[model samples]
Target: MEVDYVVVGGGSAGCVLAARLSEDPAVQVALLEAGPPDASVLIHCPAGLALLAKNGQANWGFETVPQPGLGGRRGYQPRGKVLGGSSSVNAMIYARGHHADYDAWAAEGNAGWSWDEVLPYFRKAEHNERGADAWHGSGGPLNVMDLRSPHRFGPIFVQAGMQAGFRENRDFNGAEQEGVGLFQVTHRNGERCSAAKAYLTPHLARPNLHVVTGAHATRILFDGRRAVGVAYRHERTIQSVKARREVLLSAGALLSPQLLMLSGVGPAAHLQEHGIPVLHDLPGVGRNLHDHIDVVQVVEAPHLTDLFGLSPRGIANALKGIVEWRRHRSGLLTTNFAEAGGFIKSDPAEPLPDLQLHFVIGKLMDHGRQTVWGHGYSCHVCLLRPRSRGSLLLASKDPLAPPRIDPNFLADADDLRRLVRGFRVMRDILAQPVLAAFRGREQAASAAAVSDEQVERFIRGHADTIYHPVGSCRMGSGPLDVVDAQLRVHGMQGLRVVDASIMPSIVGGNTNAPVIMIGEKAADLVKAAREPVHATREAVAA
Candidate 1:
């Protein structure tokens, strides 16, 4: 079927763009999702995020090539494949990152994308609990609310941060972003308010907006230099969908660049190796890959209650609460489990916070690698802005085959040093009197016997990704850049990338909120581009 816009991937950014672009009523939009619908009960429940990891239903379950830098361990990279993408299964922490992040984009020749220009888009997408203002918005589709029933250990983590001399921030998305506080979650009542739920679901009734589930886009249908449409797979047959105006690819950081590469839009030599005819020869399509890596330091608590024990009686309470959510729109399910976090600058001279912290009530050992009983207060420190950079390249031309992800973590000595510093800070947080009150003892293998060298070795053994990946299709003004200042593909027409992949650099915090804002702003760009063409036609008619 022919549509005005064919959006590939019904993920976080695609959902937003599909919803906003179709709002005009004159535009026909087709949103293709590779996975099933996000109607699962676990999706809405904030505490259920852990279960979604590595699950075949909603997660993509992609892994990286063994990293030689990190003792040759192949990292498990789980991205959401369902309707809302990773945002559907993510921790639900509403972090917009540092203002300097956007400004850095502008400094790198991405005009009109400075912090000032992008701030409005961020504010536009958010319906904050604190109402509308210069930094936040209200009455938006995505609802941002404070945690309803914060975990018992949440406050202890906050107090520990206070003891460490950090201030308590009521809102991380407001004012300055450098304080410990409870995260604002993407929830409406007790259900998860993913981008798909907030942006796309309400607009599904529109005749112009067609949401195709279980349709996996294989490649871009290009006419010489312009992306004309997409060829996707649904059921057992391959189907082609034509875009009358434009084909927008929002397949996210990993898949978007992979699609571009598979469609002959990436590095020339690489494409030749795969026996695919080169279309654009854009070297930067998959050159710059980055992610936030974190090391989890877990400790034990005797009286602490964990999510695993929430059974029969606990589930009855949860059902009653769900009923309340259905009736009164308030309950315990409204909160994200990892309720509070913070951004701390390790050094005083730093312009912004370099270390990001997440405190969870459950025992987290190496991204759920180990199961330690009893409730525990776990605090982790992530080097928010890393100096290290990695790359993603095609292993083959096959669309279903996962790309080669080399997130060269700890390749740089500085990154290792910074992470060590971050671990030390976490140790300080754990040692504090308030947090110590709940702590029975250290539970980690490395923590049992302490040494700076052992801690470094443990970090190398235990550090895993924080699930925030960006910069595969970097946006800039350079020969290696995949997309330009206006987010247009470097050499293709009627095609643009508007996802986390376009980020020239990774943000200082979680990437979901920034990705949503990218969708919001890209919609404006699409409309603005259409305006000029419409004006020219009207002028000629007049």
Candidate 2:
């Protein structure tokens, strides 16, 4: 099969790219996804994230190599394997990070990505239910709205933050990003509006747009240094799709770089080690890996049946919530689990908020993979900008094998120091009088820690990724950069990576929104690149 563009990976960015690029009837776009369709009830229902977190269906249950920073523990990394990508399985929190984050990307020699410039793309991708503002947009593909039936405990958490002397911020994607408040979500009504639902679903009928699910991309089919298409496995058969224009790799951070290396486009020596002939010899295809290293404070509040849990009462309430949600799309089933959260500074003197908080109305032990009994609440504190970096390398030359992921989390001493400060602030907020009635004894590794030293020990024991992994295929003009400002892979032609992997640095907040914006901007860049050819064709015809 051949098309104008082959979008390899029907994730957040690929969905948007396929949708936008196919908008012009003249263009043909094909989107390939490794997982099955996003038809599971677990993908649409906000509360189903808990179940999805534990079950590996539609999720790439990848694990990092043992990290010395976390006492040699192998951290779990869950990325979406289905359509809409991580946005389908994520908490749905709509955060854009701080404005300065984009500016930092531009400062790193990435032109046209400054905060002021990229804000337009962010606004362009959003369809905020609160109506259009200077900071947000309306009538766009992606829907952003407040939870239809937020857990009652959400306000209590926000109030507790305020009581703990933090300011209240109703919008994290607004004029400022440093305060505590209830988070808006990427939902339409009470259902999750994943990228596929927002962008790809609406345009599936477009004859020019083709979506192939359960097709795992194996490698790029290149002619010389120019990527021509993608070869993928479908139903135990290796099938290849040709691209007339370009091949857009949006397989996400972990797999995008892995695919590049598998296709022989990474560091020359590394490719040679795997016995693959080097294509472009780009040294930065898989370097610069990082993630938001997170630590959670779980409290056992068994009496609060309103919160999610496994107790009889909690189960009964959840059953009733299912009925209410199915009937009217409202109830506890609408909760994103992470009902309320905010961005704030670990130190008052910090220029911008260095830490982010996610107040979950349930015990999120081991990324919710571990089942804990009774009702409880938990708050997660993650160091937004870590100095530590890691890499993504091939475990084997085979594309079917998982990449060796090493986040090198907390390798920088300052990262741990900042997390320690953030932990104290979160602990204080959870202790506020507003939350005292619902608060219970601290659970897990945190319960035994008291002093700062003990807190650091607890963090090292329990901290893991909050599922935001970026970089690896960063965008810039430096020696180690993989993509240029247009997101085109350096030293290669007719190929671009449009995913979190292209992030020069991980943003300060949840990365879903920013990645969607990257898709929105990348679509324009791809179209802009095609205009000249179209113009010449028109001139010849005239």
Candidate 3:
């Protein structure tokens, strides 16, 4: 097959790229996805997110190597393989991060990426249910709305934070991101409004836009130094498709680099070691891996209603909740689990909030791998800007084989110290008057420890990822840069990466909203270069 563009991986970014590029009636776009279509009932239901952690229908359940910093525990990395990617399976929080984060990108020679410049894209992609404001936009594809009916315990969390001396922030995406509040989600009414549901689904009828799911991209087909096509495996059959204009890799932070290495476009020494021929030899293709290294303080709250647990009464309530949700779309099932949270500084002297919190009305441990029974609440306190960095390397030359993931979490002592502080602060918040009504037994590994030394030990023994990973294929203008200011891969032509993988650093909040913004910005760049590329398509097309 041939098209003006071929976007590999029909995840969040690929969905946007295929939809936006095909807006022009003259352009033909093809989106290839390794996973099945996002048609599961579990994906659309906000409460179904928990079930997905165990169901592998639309998730890439990848695990990290035993980390020395994490006490030799393999951290779980669950990335979405379906249409909207992680956005489809995440908590549905709509956080753009602090203004300083984007400015940091601009400060690093990445022009047009400062907070002021990127705010328009954020507005452009949002259709806030609260209506348009100075910081928000309406009539856009992505729906950002207030939860229809939050759980009973959600407000208690906010009230508790306020009672603990934290200010109430009506909007985290608004003026300041330094206070506690109930998070606004990327939902419409009660269902999940993923990128596919907002952008791609509405345009699937367009003849120019075609999507092929269950197709695993094996390698990029390059003609000399320019990317021209992609070779993929579909239903045990190898297929090749040509891209007339450009090839965008939107597989995500983990797989994007792995695909590049498979295509012979990554580190020279690493690729050569695996007996793969070299293409572009970009050394930074798989470097700079980072994420929100989070530690949770779990507390039993048997008094809270509509909370998830495994008691006989809790089981009955859950069954009743299914009926309530299906009948009116209003119940505990409508919640995003992380219904309330906030961003704050562990230290007052810091520039921005180095710590982020998500108040979950359930016992979430080991990335949902260990399900403890009984009603409870969890506060996720994550180090927003962790000092430690990790890398992604290929396990073998097989595209089907998973990559060797080494998050190297908590490799820095400062990260451990900050987390210790965050735990202390979160514990104070949970013990406030409002939450005191429901607070119960503590569940953290450091529950009995109060000293700094004990806290650090608990962090190393228990802290894990909040499912936000980025920077493997970073955007910049340096030796370590993979993509440039426009997200065009450095030292390469007719190729670009439009995903969370290009973040020079992880954003200060959840990654889904920022990744959608990256897609919106990348769409503009792709269209801006359309004329020149279109004129030269014949030469590049096979």
Candidate 4:
């Protein structure tokens, strides 16, 4: 099949790209997704996040090679394979990240990507519940809603935060993002609103758009130095689709860079080693991997108000919740797994919070529902900025095989220091009198005495990723950069990566909103590039 644009992966970014690019009505866009349709009930229910992982129905369930830094234990990295990808199964918290994070991208030779430039796209894609303003939008495709029925502990958590010296900000995505408060979730009505639901669902009927599920993009088909199309596998057969204008890759951090490498667009020697002849000699295609490392500090709770204690009776009561949500558009089912969270900077001098905290009223552990017999109060702390770097490499030439993900977490001394500070921050928050009422006892046993060295040891033993992976295909203008500011591969034409992979650095918070924004902005850039000069002049004049 041939089209104007062939978008690989229908995740948060790809969904937005396909939706926006097809808006012209004259252009043809095809979105290819390897996973099945995203109709799973678990995806729509806020409390169902635990069931999605390891179920094989919604997730890729990729496991990483045992990291030496993480004590030779292989980590489980779950990426959603269904229509909306990770956004479908995520906690649904909406965060745009700190301003400095985007400004740093522009400073690192990626012009036109400063926070000032990116914020408009963020607004343009959001339909925030808090109403429209300079910082938010009310008519955008993506839905951002204030929590309708917060957990009983939500307000107490905020008050406790204030007692601990953290200011309270109603909107984290507003003018300034510092302080403790209720999180805004990606929901429309009372259902989980993923990018697919917000962007692609509304545009699927367009004759200009074609969405193909269960089709996995295998490799980029190159015509000399230009990317012409893609080869994919579906129903045990390999098929090829050509893009007349461009082959945009939104395959995400793990797969996009890995696919580029598989297609010989990565490290020269590594591609040759796998018998894949080199197409582009970009040494940084799969380098500079980064992700937030988090340690879940669990404490036993006095009351059964936590997620675990909800009875069979509670689930039965939830039927009333379902009816209430279906009728009034408000209930317990609408809850985003995280009811409360905030940001804090370890160094007081920093402009914005460097630590991201997620407060959960559930006993979510072992990647959510691997085991759930215990009742607890859990607050996870993830260092927003880590000095650690990792890499993504082709495990084999086969596209079916998952890539080797070495986050190399805690390899840097600074990352260890930051995580230690994050743990302390969580401790301080729990120490507040309001939270002290619920605090029971420490569940994760202390490794040693409470010295700095002992804390470092505990961190090394306990630290794991917060699931925010980026920088595998770092965007910039230097020899080490793989893609440019417009997300075009550094030396390749008609090929662009518009996903988490192209992030020069990971954002401060969850990646769903930022990844969706990348898709929106990418469509604009692609549209602008293909527009005729006279037409552009006419539009500007109009």
Candidate 5:
């Protein structure tokens, strides 16, 4: 099949690209997804994320190479493989990170990405339930709303923060990002409004747009230095689709770089080692990978039956929640586990909040993969901006194999020190009188760790990613940069990467919202570039 644009990956950015580009009915767009469609009931219901987290269905479930910083433990990296990407299986928290994050991008020689410039695109993509404001928008595709069934413990968590001397912030994406409060989610009437739901689903019927699921893109087909099309696998058969104008790669932070390397567009030496012919000698294709290193503090509270767990009471409550949700789209089923969270600085002297906290109404260990039987709650404290960096390399020449991921967690001594301070601060909040009623016996490992040395050991033993990875295909003008200010791959034509991968640095909050905003702005950039050519064509015809 052939189209004006062939978008590889029907994730958050790809969905946005397909929808926005197809707006001009004159243009034809095709979106290819490696996983199944987002048709599962588990995908639409907000609480279904927990079940999705435990299983590999619709999840890449990628594991990182054992890191020396974490005492040689392999970290779990779960990315959404289905449509809407990770946004379909995430906590649904809507955050844009600190304003300085975008400014940092602009400072790195990437024009049109500063906070002041990108804020409009953010507003253009949002349809907040609270309506328009100086910082938010209304009547947009992506819906952002307050949780309909927020857990009672959410307020308690905030009160504990206040008691611990932190102010309460009702909106994290507002004028400031500090303080604690319940998170606004990407929901509409209690149901998940994933990127696919907002940007792609409603546009699927457009005659100019085509969406194909279960298509694993193996490589980008290039003609000379320009991306001409995409070659993928569908139903055990190899298939190729041509792109008349451009091939937009929105395969995400990890896969986007992997695909580039697989197509022989990455580090030439690495590609040659895997017996692949080099097409482009971009050394930065898979470099500069980093993520938020997080550690959780668990407290067992069997008395709190409302908390999610494996207990009989918890199971019964879940069943009841399902019924209530199916009937009215309300009740416990609407809960996004990390319902309440905040951004704070480990030390008051820090210019910005360097730490982010997520209060889960359940025992979450190992990204909720390991089962801990009990009714309890957990708090996650992550270093928002780690100095540590890592890289992604091809494991083999085969495109089907997973890439070798090394996050190099805590490679910097300062990252560990800040985490220690963040842990102590979280422990203090949990100890506040307001939470004394809900708090229970601290997890044995955490309770035993009192001294700074003990805390450092604990972090090395248990710290992992909070699931935000970026910079693999960063946008800048540096020798190590992959894409430019327009998001086009450096030294490559008819290609652009519109996802978290382009972020020069990890943001200080959840990445989903920022990625969606990238999609919004990228769509405009793509269209603006095409306008001049279209004008030239019209003039020639006249």
Candidate 6:
């Protein structure tokens, strides 16, 4: 098969790219996904996400090598495997990150990526329920709505934050990020508005667009220095397709770099070690990996609300919840566990808030992988920025082999210091009078202790990633930079990486919204700069 453009990965960014690129009825586009179509209720119902990590149906449940910083324990990295990608399985909170984040990208010599320049793209992709404002948008493909029914404790968490001396702001994605409030979600009529549902599904029937699920792209076919096609495995058969214009890599941070390295575009020595001859000896293909390392503090709560301990009565309550949700669609089933959260400064001296908090109305331990028999609200206190760096390297020459992921969590001393302080602040907020009615003993004994040395030790043993991984294929002019400001892979032709991997730094909050914005901008980049292609150059190898 052949097309004008071949897009790898029908993920968050890929969905946007395929939809927007195919908008030009004159062009043809193909989107390849390794997983089956997203048709399960586990992906649509907001509460069904409670079973996400265990439900292997739509996730690439990749585990990392044991990190020394995390007490030699391997960390879990669950990425979306189905259509719409992580957006379909995530908490549904819509966060674009701080303005300073994008400003820093521009300051790092990446043009056309400043907050001012990127805000327009953000607006272009959003259909915010709040209507059009200077900061928000309408009439876009993606839907952003206020949660129809947040858990009862969502407001209590905010009030407790206020009582603990934090400001209560309505919008975290507003002028300033430091405040506690109810989070706005990316949902429509209580169902998840995944990228596929918003973008790809609407355009799938267009004659110019083609979507192939369960097709795994194994390599990008390069004629010398220019990419011309791709080889993929579909239904246990190896097939090749040539691109007339370009091959856009949107395989995400983990797999995008993996695919590049597989195609011999990564570190030359590393590729040689795996017995793969080098194509492009880019030193930065799989470096600068980092994430929001966080510690979850679960506090057993008093029986003052629906979020409480496990018992016979709790079982009855859950049954009633099911009936209520199925009938009205206005019950707890519509709740995204992380219904309330905000940003804060661990130290007042810092210019901006570096600490972000997520209040889950259930006992969440180890990304909800650990089952503790009880209902207790959890607080996730993660440092917004960390100074540690990690790497991704191919384990072998096989295209299906897992890549080695070393996030090197908490390798920096400053990260641990800030997290310890944030933990104390979290305890303070929970102790506030507004939450006294529900506040119970800390699940982790002495979780409120402030001894610097002890806190540091506790953080070292307790902290894990909050799942926001980026900078593995960062954008910059440095020697290790992988892509340019326009998201074109440096030194590579007829190819671009339009995904979270191109992020120079991880955004301050969730990655779903920012990735969608990247896709929107990337489509414009291609549409504006696209030129007539020479048909004779088309080449496909299987």
Q: In model 4, where do residues sit more than 4 Å from their true spots?
A: 54-56, 306-329, 444-449, 531-542
Estimate, for each residue in 387-443, the C-alpha lDDT of model 1 and write its tens digit: 778989888888878889888888888888888878888888778899776546787
In model 5, where is the ten-residue run with the lowest total lDDT?
A: 533-542
Off by over 4 Å in 5: 531-542
Worst 10-residue lDDT window for candidate 6 reads 531-540
Off by over 4 Å in 1: 54-56, 306-332, 369-372, 531-542
Which is the better candidate, 1 or 3, if ranked by lDDT? 3
Error of 1 at 261 (Å): 0.9
Q: For model 2, which pairs clash?
A: none
Model 5, 94-140: lDDT tens per residue?
99999999999899888999999999999999999998999999999
Of 3 and 4, the candidate ranking higher by TM-score: 3
Candidate 3 Cα errors over 4 Å, as ranges: 531-542
Question: Per-model C-alpha lDDT, please?
Answer: 0.82, 0.91, 0.88, 0.83, 0.92, 0.86
Say what the RMSD of model 2 is.
3.5
Candidate 6 Cα errors over 4 Å, as ranges: 302-305, 445-450, 536-539
Model 5 Cα shift for residue 11 (angstroms) = 0.9
Which stretch of 10 consecutive residues in model 3 shows the poorest summed lDDT? 533-542
Query: In model 5, what lDDT does residue 477 have?
Result: 90
RMSD of 5: 3.5
